[model samples]
Target: MSITTLERPAAENDGDGDDGTGSGVGTDAARATVAGGEAPAAPTRIPSKEGVEVGPRRRLRESTLDERFNILGALVAGPTVATLLFGWFTPLTGPIGWVVVAFLAFIGFYILLVSLRSDREEVKDRVLTVLLISAGTILFGALAFVVVYAVGRGSVALPHLNFFTQTMELAGPLDGLDVGGISHAIVGTLIQISIALAITIPLGITTAVFLNEIGGKFARFVRTISDAMTALPSIVAGLFVYAAIIQLITHQRSGFAASLAISVMMLPIIIRASDVVLRLVPGNLREASYALGSTRWRTVWSVVLPTARSGLVTAVILGTARGIGETSPVLLTSGITAVMNLNPFSGPMISLPLQVFDFVKSPEPNIIARGFGTAAVLILLVLLLFVIARLIGGKGPGQLSDRQRRRVAQQSVDDLQRIAARNHLLTPSPAPTTQESSP
Candidate 1:
């Protein structure tokens, strides 16, 4: 055997070994044979553990709840320990100040700990997440505190059934809680808000529609004015109505005047918000309506409005909430009255906000309690309005209730049957070709 033939069998045997050691030598021999020349160079393998190939170690996966708990515990415990140790040396004053210090310490410790295990990018992400969660918790905690405080303080007056049924007319500032109620204030609030809504809803919605649907120089001017009016102060609105309508036109401060002032505050909000909502309506819907030969008014009425109904309702509720809580305008326009005035045209009215303001100013504890109660009622009323709006607005455009769905299906079937009947009537019947058919 030649020298090459003697070595070829050894190379083949090495290639057939269970270990991957001789892979490069066998590959080189095969390439040499294919080239019909000297053998190619053998690649060298770096020494590894027990002569076996090894790779970089992968970080362990932490998929269990326990792993997560440990991480969170570390993040919390490290900062707490540091805060306590530091506080032992120094001193913290307010609870708020302590919280701020603890938060800062926690951020520093958390970033340091995370950086030890995680990459820079992951550390940044975790830190941001903690910050956002902390911010949200703080915000919600403050809101919850306010609500709890209001409810706790107001509970004293809320237990009396007479508070809902009677009026403050008979009750003196120092009277016991059982003797008087906020009925007059409630009634006045309802009436004033009702009048405001009646005036604002139509005008605001129309203005929004005009701004969105009609694009003229005048429309642009109106939009600009509306945008500017959104920031117009509540006191300014009250003053405007006081000067223009109350002083110049009506020469009286009545619930009507209050309603006008509220309308002034509410209109800009409703118009601006509704305009935003209406603009969000898809252009495809309008195009489809036009394809079906619908006029601009019909498209707006049937397609655009229906599609944006829920959003428009939200806009209205937001505006109402804004106007309802306003004190200055109601105070300026509606002179305070303890007796209920059901009529809006002639007499002064007291809304819950104004009533609360009035009550809290007195030195009497009972009156202050009543003010808190009225504030709680105002909050409840706002929540109630939101619920009512949700119910009335129902679902969005493509979403329908069971009854609505059934009605639409039935109407569709009826239309199809009617169209078939009309086509039957329009078609000419076969003439007298019976003899030719027989043949």
Candidate 2:
């Protein structure tokens, strides 16, 4: 037999020097073809950029600090420049016009800077983000200003312990802030709100449940009416109670009458908000409860209400917030009196809002200070109510505190053990097998 040695073309192996071993399987195949006395086929080479391995690239992350600084610097610089330019060129006296101009300038400058580096989509996103943040900042700033102004103006009265403890009955409108207090107003406000909540919470929640669960033609009509009533003016609500109950039945203005008016104002808000919240309850929850042989009411109580409990509380709180600050209704229904009147049924009562209104209308600067003081007190009371509501509402559905979780686990264990015990009792023991061979 003749020995055959495979050799590759010199041109093919120019850059990649052959060290006896083939470059790859393709090189070995080409050599084999040549050794077989057939013309060697050209090897296929993979095309690639020198010293590069291509793959997907990762996106860059945001420079949060730098971006924040940029935004802040723009806001400051734009406002300052606009104010200076407006003062030099025009006779603009008010800060409001200057602020508007500055805001517009800031937005334009920010967008221009963003467009330099970012694409259209990114620029749009940044612009929207800045606008939203600016709006939020303005809103919070206004709120802070109000609170600060109230507290500062009221400090004249607030420092006196008697301002919280004593009544305004003995003190004249011109009396010093240290002499009189808003004790009656505080008491009246609480009593009226409590009564309103007592009346509205049940009726509103039931109405919402009716709208969502037993919806029909009547339900739709009720829903439409409630929706319309949400926009009803406070004075209109007071007038309604005045006509319906106060005039026809009571024949006098009282805290009870004021509660009726407040309830009227609050009912629609509660019903509408609760209805929305209840609708958000997952259908699967209701279906699961039914699958377990639960009735509609039982399912609502055990599963649905618990699931939406937090939201329901929020609805009630919103209603309270809306009604709490109402001056017109309280002024109309509950006649203002400086002296404390505890009786909600017979005598005239005055709430914080009414007290504030009465005080502010006075010509005395001291009385005006008392009005701000009352307003400050009202703000604090609202904040306290909010905190209380949050605490009472507790955890949302499917969320349990550590202690609650342990209790539930223990209860479950007890139930499982009871079930196992009952099954053992129901299941008969096998008959004792006889010793067949022993006999």
Candidate 3:
């Protein structure tokens, strides 16, 4: 049999040396068709550039000049019209009523303005954005009001340095702010919270780990119990401690009892929060560790814990905040004391919340000021705790601080050196290099 060689047509494929479609499959198929082989590929249609923009595309999210004008106009006109309706025509009285009407009118005007020049989607988007901004403003305003109101009212007491140093043990209800301090309450709070944290952290984290890593029917039962405990009232926790530990065992209210009650409130919160954080650890991390011959516990300790450290700290902060601010539990479990009680197990203890409660009960202005001052102190303490926790474990997964990055780089260098040393030990004489090392 004689062989036949396939060749390309001269005119059809000058630009691409194939089909002008810029595909080699077309050329291969043509040769195949000539030699009685595969079918030719379908020709591709090139896209038209008739109306396509070569300039930088406009960003959809950037606000137009019209939108800004509309917003400004609506803000001015809506409130103006609302003020007229309230003041000129309507019998509506009070700044609050006027403000509410003005806000409603503003929303209406905003939507009307946005709808005037934009599509239904853009109008909806603008309305949603305004609603969100309004919500954020309300939340921020409420927070600021609470903080300002507390600190402002307390400012009279806060300036006195002795307010943080002296205790109410020697001071009477009619005594001046200079006579009494919350030092005992502050110390007691520290002790109670430290104890509660000690008990809560290990048990909560272990329970959470059990729920996530070693789950079973028992874990589900535990989770359900934890969920129920989250809704448990502070009074109930105090009563539980009072009934079981005080009446049966200790026979008196003390900081330890208060701590136990706080732990009851904190445990569920920490467990539930920690469980969520631990669940977010990727499954592949476990698999990777196991593939490298790590035990389940070892993998969880090294891989899972490190990965979820930041979230775990957040969980702890939530629990701490919850437990620290609880008044009812501490009140019922820890009988209030004016004198500092360092021994958590022995005598009655008072915390900032309890001190505030006691101070407010008295009708004296000095006592009231002390109450507000104590509350402000509690807020500051919580804020300090939050700041510390954030500093320690604020970084999310795959995020490293400058210090951490440097540490990691150093560790990598150490690992490389160790690996090289091991290779040298295993095989005494070094093998010839494929290429000389760069200086």
- Best model number under lDDT: 3
Candidate 3 structure, TM-score to reference: 0.82
For candidate 1, report its TM-score: 0.79
Cα-based RMSD of the predictions, in order? 12.6, 12.1, 12.5
Per-residue lDDT for 24-70 in model 1, tens only? 46566776878998876544544354444322234456345543653
Clashing pairs in 3: none
Ranking by lDDT: 3, 2, 1
- What RMSD does model 2 have? 12.1
lDDT for residue 224 in candidate 2, whole number 0-100: 98
Query: How many Å off is the CA of 10 in candidate 2?
Result: 35
Model 1 has an lDDT value of: 0.84
For residue 97, model 1's alpha carbon misses the true position, in angstroms, by: 1.2
Weakest ten-residue segment in model 3 by summed lDDT? 2-11
Candidate 3: count of backbone clashes, pairs at least 3 residues apart or interchain: 0
Instruction: Score candidate 2 by TM-score against the native.
Output: 0.82
